[model samples]
Target: MSNRPYIVGNWKMHGTRAMLAEARAIDRAAERLIKVEVALAPPSTLIHACRKEANLIGIGAQDCHPADGGAHTGDISAAMLKDAGAGFTIVGHSERRADHGETNVLVKQKAEAAIEAGMGAIVCVGETEEDRDAGKAEATVGEQLKASLPEGEAAAANVTVAYEPVWAIGTGRTPTPEDIAIMHRNIRAQLVEVYGEAGQEIRILYGGSVKPENAVELLSADDVGGALVGGASLTAESFLGIIIAAAGDDAE
Candidate 1:
């Protein structure tokens, strides 16, 4: 929303109390790297700890239950995440979609829930390698984005779109810049179609196997507002490298 590149780290199923030190260091570096917007989604157990350590960087949740309160066991809701100091939550990530069989409708509900709970939601939508090979990548992602995005004007303000190809995630395989640019352009068109001009303000983040080496080139891709880093974000050293890359782009 601030026009600063939104670089987020998804620490998925990682981090303990000991990892707070790295979070602190990342936060400190983020304070200095004012040109870029940095955030981290640590495990739920460490959300509060990371929040306490983060002064400039944002602390967020990897996922959240759509319900505010319920009998559901081992599920944290958007309200609970906000209470724990998470300013935002990632919904519809590839892992959740594949591992938990999450549907587009359910993902949309989750995004709406997060917005209702006064938190931001990063809605993820991407296709698999098979979809790409079949020439259905854009079509697949377009449908997912349309179904997964929350409704209303508030969505334009509270929602961020993350594109993470299923096959590329954790595989050290990445699409070419031309491919990423094309996908992002399609995504942007979809957003504009849904949210109108306000959609232009929503940041579209590129994810999956994002690291220091590829940060600059990836961020330079058309409509790539930032990145949703995975393993590269576990340590301050690697994560900061990506953040610095975003900052460098912002400077230009």
Candidate 2:
């Protein structure tokens, strides 16, 4: 996946059957933009629908339960997501961390479950605004990532790390390129410490307020392998712009 940007759209709680049109459009564009890796993690209800519409683009789930089969109510398991045609799943997203009170240990279990189900896991880690203001941004995120990541060498193959500042999501704010670079570099160092040489192969993506207008610059940051987009991904026009930016950046 070297030189190839993995641009993913996290539609969150949004999207219904009506949104399949946008998914189709994104898939068609992804087919043309072979230089970039494009994927979408729609709401669980739409995962099958999006997969049916997607050929080139990957279809994934927003989250998954760690248990393969459980008495847990209202939770979809990683195996279920795989059966629904999802190639990957996002775990430990900031919203999940905050709204659901997900801890680093639980996130790691979720990631391990995804890997066990034969799917990729994008484990998210980020610091809150307070942590950043207190000069603990790097330390906070680093610890979260270390604990949240799945164990074993398989992690280097099936896991991807996404850094999304909690305060930036949907707020239209973004860290400057230098900040992004610094955070990514710190994350890289941690990865290397944990996984040795194989860690360098793991993709560390930037998220939070990622739009087409800034995709190129954000993705150009050192060790920024791609992006985890939010609102802008709900539309083909806007999402395609970011994908195009990634393709252009790959060419460089």
| Superposed Cα RMSD, model 1 | 1.4
1-252 in candidate 1: lDDT tens per residue? 577899999999988899999999998877778899999999999999888888789999999999989899999999999999999999999999999999999999999999999999999999999999999999999999988999965888999999999998999999988999999999889888998898888899999899999999999988899999999999999999999989994433
Scored by CA lDDT, what does every candidate get? 0.92, 0.92
TM-scores, one per candidate: 0.97, 0.97
Which regions in candidate 1 have their CA more than 4 angstroms from the true location?
249-252
The reply for model 2, stretches above 4 Å from the true place, is 249-252
Residue 57 Cα positional deviation in candidate 1, in Å, after optimal superposition: 0.5
lDDT of 2 at 54: 87
Model 2: weakest 10-residue lDDT segment is 243-252
lDDT of 1 at 199: 85
